[model samples]
Target: MVDKSARTPAETKDAGVLIVGLGRFGSSMALTLDRLGQDVLAVERSPGLVAHYSDRFPIVEADASNPEALEQLGAREFSVAVVGVGTSLEASVLITGNLVDMGTPQIWAKAISAEHGRILQRIGAHHVVFPEADAGNRVAHLVSGKLLDYIEVEDGFTIVKMRPPRETQGFTIEQTKVRERYGVTIIGVKSPGQEFVYAEPTTRISSNDLIVVSGHSELLERFAARP
Candidate 1:
């Protein structure tokens, strides 16, 4: 377990996730990350939004369009910043551009339009998300209610992180024949043993492990329901 309180200055510098503009996308992103044990700082122009999430998340009250606000929030130091300014396209673009200028790596922005997405790409955003599209998928899957997180990396391959059924806790990769069974391969296991998981075939599946498998989404679903 990472000792959050015992973190040194070096550690603190290494550990940072910044969120600019606390609308629905930003707020949910912050909440989800905080729930997943990551320290998140959300910066919003509105004082009301800042106050609402201040107790749960570290928040800064500042205008995202202003470069000075980025400085105030120590934006340059973040390892990955989420510029989730969904309300205004201009504000989202501005925040993303400023973060790029400041050399913050791995910025994920929630965009509304094709032109806005293109602008974000030109401004050096690492990832662009469409929240309405995501919400629709989330809602559709809620009825199905099996998938945990569906991350479309590239090509036709999608990374589905899901919970295994009760029976497969102590099984081996070879024993499970996961690849042949589901038409998808168990790429990795994110075990909560102080760090991340491995895709090694020999790695045993534990009950608490977060199985991060990659393949077609359809095949990934089969793996999610198996023993």
Candidate 2:
């Protein structure tokens, strides 16, 4: 393991995150966390991956499936750890179990399928992510030609960007009564050449305007599907 620097135990415990595996999912997480200014220590079993990212991140070539390797690298110092090994279910489970045994406060594991997610949760993973599955679902929603973008904030709630329907165009928000009729809230609007602005009760919608709306997933889908 490569020691980046000397840090107090409290600082390490409070701020750092340990990320195991450097495949597509793991690498993406590391890059995003780094961009967000979070302190990250990455571990990958492949020497090539470790070398490719070492100059950009604090990474080490280590098999995190082995508890001993994690112990030697002081994995317990991290308050949160992410197991991004999706290719091998066995390796993924082993790493997650190791982190749980070490009493990591928050564990996020990637799951390739529903069963894999269940096992991770049963083994004490605090959060289970299905990146590929979620991406596919999002794309499926976008392909309908109405919703430009869709994000499910939770089980039922969603926020979407879409073109204003004909009924909404050429009318102010208050005039359209969209919220009253459609059960969705227009949070913002973007004109053809202007920056996105917060939606107001009197904000007028044009045929070319883009709107951001938030509501239950079903309601948002219905609103977007409107002509």
Candidate 3:
């Protein structure tokens, strides 16, 4: 894992955010920022949404993917920029790259997936948003059967407590270092009458037991798919 450096200081004196793409995400985020008393400039290719939110937001009707349009909007003067284009990956890439090149104080982009997110990261996106995948997990967990628990965390990680596999039952915890392999840590566990205790490397998990785990977004899928 690359060592993340401390975040740069927020531009307290700079003007409010400049958002590209007036789709659902752009309008929604712009509205929120406007409500927060920040000056918000929204750019949109859609004339419909532009008219819809122009009165409520400071909007510039233009194709966000165009660097010339961004320059016309004076986006370089904003404290932050959000590229919220969905569907068009090429447009998203171009707009985000232009925003970074323009030296927008901060650039936030909505990514389609982990792989796509990596590409954006390489191109200078300050952060990747995965709202759908995250909300899906929380919604799916509500309909779960027998699974004790699950919770979502920042950057789309999950915490789960579920039963161990029958094949792995009776084996000492040390025999299988799940934490090392799965990139998740077992936080705690409960086995019927046994007292619920936080998990340790030496803690043996039995068959038909509940194991609390914390892991990355894909880690939860691995556990749920386990036979």
Candidate 4:
């Protein structure tokens, strides 16, 4: 077991994240949080994985599915915990339940299926994410060829990056009246060989310009589908 007190007072105060498992999802989450300057403690059962990432972040070899192991590592003190062991449903559920029993203020668990997600919610996971499913949905939208990139901010709302439609080519944003006509707002525009610029009334659209627009999902899809 690794010493939890190895972190200094300042690091401990900011290190409220406890992540279990070192699979793809867990590693990605740790890397992103680290990049954002968030302190993280990762627990994994695989010695190889622990060794691989030990230099990158603080990681210990332990099985989080065992509640005793979690307590030994001071899991209760963490304000946030993530159960990223989705390969085994039993292990995932057990870890989530342990976090809940420990009164973790925020518990995020990964679910492979709808049934798994419902189970996690029933057991008190504060948040459940279906990374594979969400990624598939996003890719489906991109494969349509209309949207260069898509982000669904919430139900029925989305922000998309797409090529300017032919009708808007060579026309100023104010003159095109895209907002008035499509009920979507162009947030920014990126012309080739230049940085992205915030959209303005006087900003003109070019045939090759890429635009970022935000609106209801259906409206944005219709706008992007323009000929």
Error of 3 at 139 (Å): 1.7
Q: How do the candidates rank by lDDT, highest first? A: 2, 4, 1, 3
TM-scores for every predicted model: 0.65, 0.92, 0.60, 0.89
Candidate 4 per-residue lDDT, tens place, 1-227, comes to: 67442343345543568889889999999989988998888999987888889888888788888999888777877899988999999999999999999898999999999999999999999999999998998899999868999988877689999999999999999999999999999999999999999999999999999999999988998999999
Candidate 2: 10-residue stretch with minimal lDDT: 1-10
lDDT of 3 by residue, 99-203 (tens): 888877688998778887887889998887866776687778746643566677776677877777654467656666666666667787788888899877677
Cα lDDT of model 2 by residue, 1-227, tens digit:
55354233455666778899999999999999988998988888897888888877788678899999888777889999999999999999999999999999999999999999999999999999999999998999999669999898888899999999999999999999998999999999999889999999999999999999999999988888888
Backbone clashes for every candidate come to 0, 0, 0, 0
lDDT of 2: 0.90
Q: What is the lDDT of candidate 3?
A: 0.73
Candidate 4 wrong stretches, greater than 4 Å: 3-11
Name the TM-score of candidate 1.
0.65
Which is better, 1 or 4, measured by lDDT? Answer: 4
How much lDDT does each candidate structure score?
Answer: 0.75, 0.90, 0.73, 0.89
lDDT of 1 by residue, 1-227 (tens): 11122223343475768888777778888899989999777777776776677778677777868887676556777789998887688888888988888888788988887788888998899898877876676556545746677776655578777776655578887777777767787777877764666767677888887777889766776667665
- Cα error, residue 160 of model 3, in Å, equals 11
Residue pairs in collision within model 4: none
